[model samples]
Target: MPVHRPGTARREHHAAGVLLAVLSALALLLTLPGAAQSADGENVPPRGSARMGQGVLEHDGQGGEPRGGDAVQTEGVDVSSHQGNVNWSALWSSGVRWAYVKATEATSYRNPYFAQQYNGSYNIGMIRGTYHFATPDTSSGAAQANYFVDNGGAWSRDGKTLPGALDIEWNPYGAACFGKSPSAMVSWIRDFLTTYKARTGRDAVIYTATSWWKQCTGNYSGFGSTNPLWIARYDVSPGELPAGWGFHTMWQYTSSGPIVGDHNKFNGAYDRIQALANG
Candidate 1:
């Protein structure tokens, strides 16, 4: 065997050590879950930053104030069984003009309070709509969308009924992206929107955080101008929207508001909002 110099062996060993370190770091980054990697790797701000009982603010960069500067906007609330026995009349009297009720979740779970919240808000002279909480891991989007419409997503020519909304946010059960690839999530959303529109004759609104949308759906913007965007961010200006949307349709600014659940701001005036409800 050829004899090697001691200094050369030391240099080689050092190089190998550096290489192993680099590989380990790369592996760790690859294994880390795709969280909010928006601009500054900070989007999807914390929930209920400006609330009474909500916890410490997350301060993610994804959320912000409503758009449409100088234009008068409408305030609304979104609720489900989480907020038990809502007082819709009091909310209306408090200047809340609209509501989005959680109607269904995944494929099997339906909100028991959907009828009461939906009809209650409408009866109190508030524009009301139903939203489906997407559980992509549990079932296909089309199936979930059908279940939503069958339960409470169907809208009528009644001027106060807004189109159904697709609530695609964090994965409550499993992986953050529901263990699906970005392309898979985009496909699921398309399936849900396609089926929803076909059944209801109206486009479904999409509610998501900026970073969550980017991470989960690869920032999919295929819905174009049809599906309205409802961006969820607490205590910050929605710095950037997802692809294909310059402004948001509604902004869910907080979770614990005057009436509980989520507090929302429609981007346009009451007339424009009425126009949206009509469709």
Candidate 2:
């Protein structure tokens, strides 16, 4: 028979209690919304939740741009899962004529709120489309594009669904350019654009910032001629466009809007938005 030491059982009980408390706390964190558990049991930011212009506002400070002035532009907003069940009717009543909802990120995740946001906007009579956040480091662009289309980035000729957009901006996770060289970045973009076009039969809009375009793609001019540009600049006049694009099709002028965080302006009038949708 072994003799028990004084206070040994009490110390063991105290240690067990501390361990249980720590585990319970971890479990609570994992169950919290927007926190996802990876295969390795690590808590990570929810996949497919990266929003359009997420890094723009952080990288480039907002600039002054008069809203609804003499400029004949259409008001629009872009949203992701972060916006969760947006109030489309309020936006429509506020003169927002178009919207873009995020569909996927890389090839791993899809927006869980895609249906509510995508269909709700259309039902409210707003010309709407979906966008995919590019994570060039995770997978090939073609694979991400296919995942986007398979998820919710598909297009239709209903005159209400605009073609999907590829959001190739600053990488929010790790490297600014996802650790790819300029030429490699350009090739990745080309792969994504080509795949998206092949899958949907429409030229996908390229959403990026001038600085990012110049830095990551070495200011590649080839995409300008084919892909419609959705320039992200909070400046007064969209600052400067990327190489080869004479004009921007859409300009995200502000990340702080009346109702939504990301607001944009279609370069032309409402009819242009319709025309873009028609295509």
Candidate 3:
């Protein structure tokens, strides 16, 4: 039997410790979630940053002023339901330049609201339009995409069909029908985007909450350079954006805006999409 030298063993152990430290730091950087406060510190991911009655002054990045010699023109909303009423003409004249409708959800579920709104209003006019897929674990990526396209009217060959969007967010707790890991969720999104683009020739747009952007989908390697981001952040002020995304085409900042013909207000954002695409 050969005996190992004590000094040599210590050197080997030290080298292994250093390698582990590097790996740990890299993982922490990659998987870091948002530092936003949660209700009871539990996970309650909202489409935007959790307001949770904080009385925080969530700023609208494009409204209230002009900056750097450019007028803020992008504005729009997402409407799947409106207090049990469908108001089409009112939405068009309200200066809503873009609208995103919920098309399909995961687990073989479809958004009845989307059909009601899209068909009810004849698909809100003039501005851009897109459909969002609620990715759940129960269905495969391609199946989920197919359900959305079938139900959301993506196959109509209508001139108004905009790019598809993947709504990647944390669902209500205990909905594990979708994969739990962020990478897995991103993989599903990428697969759906790939198939959708191959069929339709339209690349996908990614929609996610601020926390989820920071934690899960922010650094997803599956997305390519051409994908646009639709980020939702209810911040006191829209300061510097998150570090990872080089370009964000739209920012959904406020959920308290009035729309004619609807008693309850809706949420929306400023569309820098043209600038994003042009650039």
Most accurate candidate by TM-score: 2
Report the lDDT tens digits of candidate 3 across residue range 94-199: 7655556566565354555655565545555533444554545566778767766666625324544456777665553224224456666667777778777776
Give the lDDT ranking, best first. 2, 1, 3
lDDT per residue as tens, model 2, 104-185: 9998888888899999999999999999999999999999999999999999999999999999998765568989999999
The CA lDDT at 12 in model 3 is: 91
User: What is the C-alpha local distance difference test score of each model?
Assistant: 0.78, 0.89, 0.53
What's the TM-score of every candidate structure? Answer: 0.76, 0.84, 0.61
Report the error of model 1 at residue 226, Å: 1.8
Best by lDDT: 2
**Where is the poorest 10-residue window by lDDT in model 1?**
47-56
Off by over 4 Å in 2: 1-46, 67-69
Q: Is candidate 1 or candidate 3 better by lDDT?
A: 1
Model 1 regions more than 4 Å off: 1-69
